[model samples]
Target: MDFYLVFTIFIFAGALIGSGLSFYVEYTKLEALESYFSENKVVCDNKRFWGRNTHIDRFYRMLLISQLLAMPKTHIKRGDVTEAELAAIPLSLKRWALWPINFGFIWFASIIIWNVWYR
Candidate 1:
């Protein structure tokens, strides 16, 4: 096998592992929040899940979700998001954003690095 092929495979594997670990961590937080919300009888406003603006800014949503999980009080103070949005973050949109985006970023970065350093 060619060295570059092997190196590329290794880089891809590392990127996949990193993405999996990252998603796993995020899923855990989502689950924890779900449990907490359930236990506390916190009712999320489901209507606001899609958000206030008609425009769907996925990047902003992702950042808002992270902020919601990491700094709930502070993020909530902004008053643009709701618990439903936080909870919905792990659903379809999130899966789309996390895996593909991370993989693409890593793949491109690795290819660029390889070209610059090896080629």
Candidate 2:
């Protein structure tokens, strides 16, 4: 049961990190989209390649997911994260802006309780 609890925490943390990484990747996409929109301004064309994924990008994205999934459990728990109390540091860096720690809390608790109590 304790193993399940720990495993739940591990999976939840992996999910949180995965989500944060994906969100950051998507933010980069949004920045590119904004740049394109600003430069083109609805220029009339027939090539509608919206939301299309390039081969290399998809490959790397899959690689990232696989790499994260394969990462050792100890590394994440011991990973060095930036949680400094400085005036110049941005809130996004000082805090887990993309996927905060509470996600791990709720995710693990829900999974553990559901499995232990209901299963």
Candidate 3:
């Protein structure tokens, strides 16, 4: 098999695994996260905009919360997240929620780079 083909397969597999992990997190941990940030306006707005108790909404909610947790300082400065709320989030939850999203982002960027380099 061609090296490019093998590389593409590897990337595709990683993306799939990341997506699966995201799905798992959405179903298993999203509700706990929602309760944790229930008082935050940004999270409330996201729930309202995305609607509640649906897969797509869950996915977006997970992404939003993950972003908020990832950059507490930025979100706090923007008044989207309070320091107390950010501090309340568990470190383990942060790791579980962040890894898949981060992986997906890096994989996507690498795919772009690969395409550019080969084309």
- TM-score against native, each model: 0.36, 0.29, 0.90
- Order of all candidates by lDDT, from best down to worst? 3, 1, 2
All models: lDDT?
0.53, 0.42, 0.87
Between the candidate structures 1 and 3, which one is better when assessed by lDDT? 3
Per-residue lDDT of model 3, residues 1-119, tens digit only: 98888888888898888888888999998888889898888889998999867888898988899999888899889988888987787888878888887888899997997798689
Clashing pairs in 1: none
Q: Compose the digit string of candidate 2's lDDT tens values, residues 1-119.
A: 68667776677677767667655644444333223223222211211333345644433433332232234253245441111212233444323322333455566677777677647
Candidate 3 runs further than 4 Å off: none
After aligning candidate 1 to the native by TM-score, how far in Å is the CA of 111 from where it should be?
3.6
Model 1 lDDT tens row, 70-93: 565665576644566566554654
Top-TM-score structure, candidate number: 3
Worst 10 residues of 2 by lDDT: 39-48
RMSD of each: 8.8, 12.9, 1.4
Q: Which one wins by TM-score: 1 or 2?
A: 1
- In order of TM-score, best first, we have 3, 1, 2
